[model samples]
Target chain A: MRENAKDPERHARRMAAKQKIMQSRIDHARKEQGVLLVLTGPGKGKSSSGFGMLARALGHGMKVGVVQFIKGKFSTGEEAFFRDLPGVDYHVMGEGYTWDTQDRQRDVAAAEAAWEVASRMLADDRYQLVLLDELNIALRHDYLDLDRVLDDLQARPAMQHVVATGRRAPQQLIELADTVTEMKVVKHAFKDQGVKAQKGIEL
Target chain B: MRENAKDPERHARRMAAKQKIMQSRIDHARKEQGVLLVLTGPGKGKSSSGFGMLARALGHGMKVGVVQFIKGKFSTGEEAFFRDLPGVDYHVMGEGYTWDTQDRQRDVAAAEAAWEVASRMLADDRYQLVLLDELNIALRHDYLDLDRVLDDLQARPAMQHVVATGRRAPQQLIELADTVTEMKVVKHAFKDQGVKAQKGIEL
Candidate 1:
């Protein structure tokens, strides 16, 4: 069957069968609601993809909120571009990187404060999309209670979407998320080629 | 070692040591050049991240080009948002999804035309960043010549960056890329939960 796929007639027949199944699947999916997305693992673009969704939400004229949990020491390109955009409420609440701060108490305090802002957005239906940048790091460190976080997410407005991004997402979060993508590193310029991070690329 | 992270003083000492090594690496990385990034795998966010980088490039006031390969049948939110934006030269050249078209000759022709546009952008220094969206699909289907594509990429402007996105990226492209990320699907809304594609999120 695989070898015969090159034949035009056979290919068309196979595709027709596939089209039928796909059409039925599309017809069956009638539920309309907000989705919870988790972008995690030890590769790049988790935050970038979150920001992309932020851009898409803005394109659709939807109100959105962003809360950064663990990268406040230095400003980023996304922050510079999106901070002042209309319909976007952005906040960077992290004290700094954990190693740079070197204080668990401060990190915990920062995570708590950021979660407060996130929870408010989750409660408000006006915020159609909320991006919790690096929130997984805070969860991994136990700075915030995972159960409380899960509860808040589950209890958010029915039409409000959320995107949580970071590395090493917890099992509970993955299970709860409607969509989850784990980015795996194949090669890294900085690590493999000793190239420095570029402004538009990595910053 | 991980257990002792709770001790503030010990944590500080460990961080200090790590910082020294990090600083040395930072200092050692002196060479600078444009990077080629490949985002691939069977999960979502590859094109989203490519568009995210496109946004990042635009934020910096750099000129960019985008050529979408397999997603031209229907207009996308990104295209609607980015097509008229300043400094963006966007083009969608795919005939349609392979199954939808089911014509190998037409699909190959479309791929060929898309590659022409992409190659032009690669050669032009004015396009600081060029996004070859879903080019890997063309390569995978043998609609476009991989060796020619690689040659064009290698011969691009010295300071030009390129991002190619799609699933099942060839190993040669991965080997040549400065950074490669493979998005692994832990779960999917459309697949696992039978949820339709949402406008702001999936589209």
Candidate 2:
């Protein structure tokens, strides 16, 4: 026996309803709201991943602000690549990593300076992503305060993505995070073969 | 013009030598071997990027492993996406987040258990890339020994790539890194809009 086929108009109506629901779900699934991403682990390529995201966002014409907290010195490949890119706003630790700062006050001052740029970016709703590089360690090291950071982060005007990468994110900070990621060390190349870090590959 | 045509091989030799020199400098730039990548910071896509790398590596027919430290008991879209993929070894936090554990001893014990699997992967050269998700915070919280982790990473069998994502990477770890990235938060949607974290986007 042949089953009766539905009318074309009814079939189209049903399909349209299904498509609408699917589209709605897709839209909801997208992280259109600003997100906090914490990248913690003792591994390589955390910042590389952040740079890669920055590049992709910039490619799409999204404005980006990068505030490196602990690391300032050494010419990074990311800095060299995106310093002049139209949508990129980059700030490095011109003095280098915190340990080399030689003065805690100087380290704190540098962090504050970087945060000034970062804070402005956060306030400006134009940026799609703001990278607070190594900020967690900065806080852990007392370069910045948790209350002030949380307050400022809360005060940002609109939907803006933020990335904080470091190893010792405070409990309060993690609690506040929308998304937390921990990178584990399973195995690495340098350990196995004594290979030194490569510039483009590592930096 | 005729003389230039005769110099093609000479030009190739010079180019090769330049590449070699660049490689050597990159290999020798750092006093330490292996690159420590701490993927810490506040952002939404750290794990996404790491898993993206895993997908690319697997696409290239390389083996990969994912050991999630504190993210079990929660539904993750990434887990759904990669769990069934070939050439991937999956490990989720058997226990939930540390706060939920409420016992320092137990949290340390869980970290140890996860480390067992992660450390094994770090030692094995089978996987081209191993993602140690959330291991940074564990170390920061003193759930694991820095030296022990470094020792395992140093002794890894194959020249493997490792990605560690978290927040607040320690100074010692930063000093040990070939590349360090900080994902700074300049703006965020949650603080401004009070939007609840939706599934797939934040979870």
Candidate 3:
């Protein structure tokens, strides 16, 4: 493939122009700090993406924390795999889906309890990466105080990263996040193809 | 929190109605097969989500194949962690970004070479999950035949799942996919806050 690098001069010229622009941008980006990442919307993989980060953080031997909300109805592959890992502090505090639970007071208590665990992770600098899995769901239903939640996130350790995932994230959280990704649904297997959730994929 | 389940009678009534509807939907969804998931858009986590699925599949002890395209210039945290795993076949087959490589002919050859490897995995049922990372970039640039790619995917083993990740996914690929997620960026650290990519997070 290296032999196929014909028109070397033309390629060099083009690359030089692009390199200058890219280098300037890189030069300007000098800040380094923790990031508040909000992963929200109707598509799949919001939680999956967060877990991906967890895996990466673990690869680097970083201490991590996981607090899962609104998803304790069944055992998940992620929880099963990550819970016993050496540097992980994993907690699944949800009672279940809102419709299944169907009790606002109970849901509120669960969210509050989950928040306590999450807040502890935020305050501690030892946890380099903390995944607040589906925390936005609790916030969406007003089970957790949005103001307090935002305050804790903002006041977290300077080098501590947080990833919050769920659907229909609060607008205020979006504004506060350093990186926000809204996963839009183009198609879904369960809804469009009559496919049930399967192990090692949706679970 | 269970003690906070006040208005038990009303809660039970609501739960029964919701359960009936959910059960009916579950009953109707009888198909069982692998999923074709496409993760695309400008937001982050497209590749991360694919890798997350990779971790979940590994947790279940499934044989997995990973082919990275247009991202072999520098090693990534995922490549480092997953490449040496027991049941994984990891291949980094790209010559780098198109701008850096700066040769359409060479890029086409590299993409073709990658497709050959991907097609082999698609044909084998022993590989339960295949992650074609950044394949959309090649497809988007017309380096590979879109129809041929789609045909190969459709003809893959019935129980073999595949995840394709990148930005600006073609419409035809989205239409053929069982699940498609378009990640919309509300904010980005590099763009909005001038923050450089960090280890174990964006790398």
Candidate 4:
């Protein structure tokens, strides 16, 4: 029995009011609203988590779109896993990582193309979820328009969730996000030793 | 300025939509309803992310509970930072990592105690989020009861969100999770050379 908060009856009512929440089924539960989320920080797994959410949304028979910015050349497990799914659309920016890119012009062009696809998904209400993988990196590098990205996310139709994953998400984006998750690195086996990234685990 | 599902929309409306989405919030997020989430796989940062979420909940005036299953004796930067945070109840299973804890009995006892705290949080909505840090490792090593854990999780209060983090989460837990995130390590900086886990970055 909870004795700390309100009256006993009120507490009881609060306790009993547990059946109303629907998890992972937010769109179905509300059918009136959606979320704009940012998964950022210096830690790894931001993109992985966003992609996981994308997979979950797709599994629910919902259409999903993915636009990977600042990442075009390398193949990710996510791409291999989700690209084949039905009703799923994907666009990978071919400029690759910043360190890997030789031409800034090419990188900017690739980022714009990726943003174009992501923008389309943002406006479309039919796609239940849109994953802007590494969009923050594009923004951080000044390849994409920060105000434009923010504006598009805000104007996105209801009943659709947009996930932006990358490190150093803009402060403005953080301020605008309904939910902002920062992945912090703590204990890593790689740093402990010489454990390298392996297949089926990393890319 | 709208696009059809089968047809691409005008680029400008799509851009406008992003603007709007940026301004709005993710209302009634899965967390508001208390979603059960599991962070698993070989990559690091699983427990770290869960802890970060725990901190976020605490910062928002939400009660939080943390049970570090396989993390003991190893003092982490996160523990130090959040140890003094308000509304955060922290408990670390002092059994250290599983590899170091060769004693099965001790490991089981540690896990059982951690589960005691976790299960209680699962039933109590006051603790909006309860994190079982490195729980999968304990579960994988058979230190914790899989069936009991799942049953308790299913019976948890709808307003309670339980996050289990670590490598190799049990099949049943993954199947039951409203959100299951598998952290994949792709080209980490530590592995590039022999850079050790720097304090404040990776403990």
Give the range of the ten consecutive residues with the poorest summed lDDT in model 2 chain B: B1-10
lDDT of 2 by residue, A1-203 (tens): 01112243443455466557644654555445677767666655456456545644553456888887755333354455556668778787545554344455565678778777888888899887887777877787666667888888878865787878777777777777666655554344444444565433442
Mind giving the per-residue lDDT tens digits that candidate 4 earns over A113-141? Answer: 88888888899998878888888888886
Q: List the residue pairs that clash in candidate 1.
A: none
**Please, what are the lDDT tens digits per residue for candidate 3 over residues B10-99?**
765776787788878777878888999999999989988998888888877789999998764333677877889899999887688877
> Candidate 2 docking: what grade?
incorrect
Q: Tens digits of per-residue lDDT for model 3 on A1-203?
A: 12224566676677678778776876887888889999999998898899888888887778999999967433377777788889999999868876777777787899999999999999999999999999988887777889999999999998889999999989999999999999999999978889976775862
Global CA lDDT computed for model 1: 0.83
Per-model TM values vs. the true structure: 0.92, 0.49, 0.90, 0.50
Better of 3 and 4 by DockQ: 3
Q: DockQ for each of the predicted structures, in order?
A: 0.51, 0.05, 0.45, 0.03
What does candidate 4's lDDT look like per residue over B1-92, in tens digits?
Answer: 11221222333345456545533422212123456677776654566556545533543456778787866433354566455657878888
lDDT of 3: 0.84
Error of 2 at A193 (Å): 3.9
TM-score of chain B of 1: 0.91
lDDT of each: 0.83, 0.63, 0.84, 0.63
| Residue range A31-149, candidate 1, lDDT tens digits | 67899999999987888788888887787788999999977323366777788888999999858877777777787888999999999999999999999999998888778889999
Worst-scoring 10-residue span by lDDT in model 1 chain B:
B1-10
Native-to-model Cα distance after best TM-score fit, residue B67 in candidate 3, in Å: 0.9
**Interface RMSD, model 3, angstroms:** 4.7
The numbered model that scores best in lDDT is 3
Per TM-score, the best of the predicted structures is: 1
Q: Write the per-residue lDDT of candidate 1 for residues B68-128, one digit (tens) a residue.
A: 9987433376777788888999999858787777777787799999999999999899998
Per-residue CA lDDT of model 2 for B60-134, tens digit only, reads 566878888777332365576567667889888676665444455566688888899988888777866787877
Best to worst by DockQ, what's the order?
1, 3, 2, 4
